[model samples]
Target: MPLCLDPNGNRCSYWPQDAHFVWEKNGQKIETCVSEQTHVLADGRVHVLTWIKDAVVQDSQYCCLVSSKAGNKMSTSYISVEGSNNQDSWSRGFASWKSIISEHDKLMTNWKKTWESCNKKDIV
Candidate 1:
């Protein structure tokens, strides 16, 4: 699945060629849910509605487990950060420029105030 991130956030999931040189064929599976008590099961299947709020880096692995009377299997996939990189990069650049401009404006205002105060003879 593709992971979504806000603009200006450097948290990207770029696929590193070196990282995948060695990987396990089958990995452990994890369940996604809030709590067992909150889980709703119908017809031997679990159905739940939940929202996950957090931040994750690109290429983060997510695993899921499938179980049955026959046997159990595991599946894993990585989140793609390319989706947010380009878009967020531009946004972050703009935000950085804005911060710089704000700082410049504050410096100029202080300089002007100091200049005016010095002109009045009371300023030493």
Candidate 2:
């Protein structure tokens, strides 16, 4: 969710690459990467996990989970991303915090559209 602008043409952006994720339900785990299929739990709940690239640094990962039950009007979701970098050092051409905030808004808009579409046919 980082964005950058540079006058020196060195701008860099964060994007998911070669991602994989798994979903857990009722003590069972299932793969859900690029398949678009939800994992069904023993209690008839649907769960999914998604992964995205965390940052430019190597060995970074981001994951999210969403769960829903039949006849339930609400669902639970969680997200987490992790990475390690030298805190004291500075990296040039990195996106500023402000740029990241702006990019987050844009990402949220896209996510909202996907969420609406996913729940569009659900029974209220």
Candidate 3:
């Protein structure tokens, strides 16, 4: 996390713009309530990031993405948000939920075929 100083050289915080900060959970976007997010220096080096406002420890994803047309690339960092409450465990478990609909459809299709093949009229 980056920290700045006030006019009196007192320590302060900084927040990254919307383009740089993204927070999500279970593939759903979450509120990025933060006092300070990113602090970029003169040389374009991201010194520090502060995310402290309305931030709770849970199974969520935080990403810091930077892209440029010069080459076009991205970077990200993962930090597991764990809470003592242990409330968002079962509902949001997967670290990465990939193609959920496709996976569910496949499972349902197989289950449907099995159910149809077990016709009650032909039951042994």
Whole-model lDDT, model 3: 0.50
Candidate 1 off by > 4 Å: 1-60, 67-69, 77-82, 87-95, 118-124
Query: Could you estimate the TM-score for every candidate?
Result: 0.34, 0.22, 0.29
**For model 2, how does the per-residue alpha-carbon lDDT over 1-124 read when each residue is reduced to its tens digit?**
1233233444322212222344443334545433443344444333443443222343322333432232222223333323334432334325566688889999999998888887896723
Best by lDDT: 3
- Best-performing candidate as measured by TM-score: 1
In model 2, what are the clashing residue pairs, if there are any?
A: none
Which candidate order results from sorting by TM-score in descending order? 1, 3, 2
- lDDT to native, each model: 0.47, 0.42, 0.50
Please identify model 2 stretches exceeding 4 Å from their true place.
Answer: 1-95
Write candidate 1's Cα lDDT for 11-76 as tens digits.
Answer: 233321122111221242223332221222333232322232325554366554434344555556
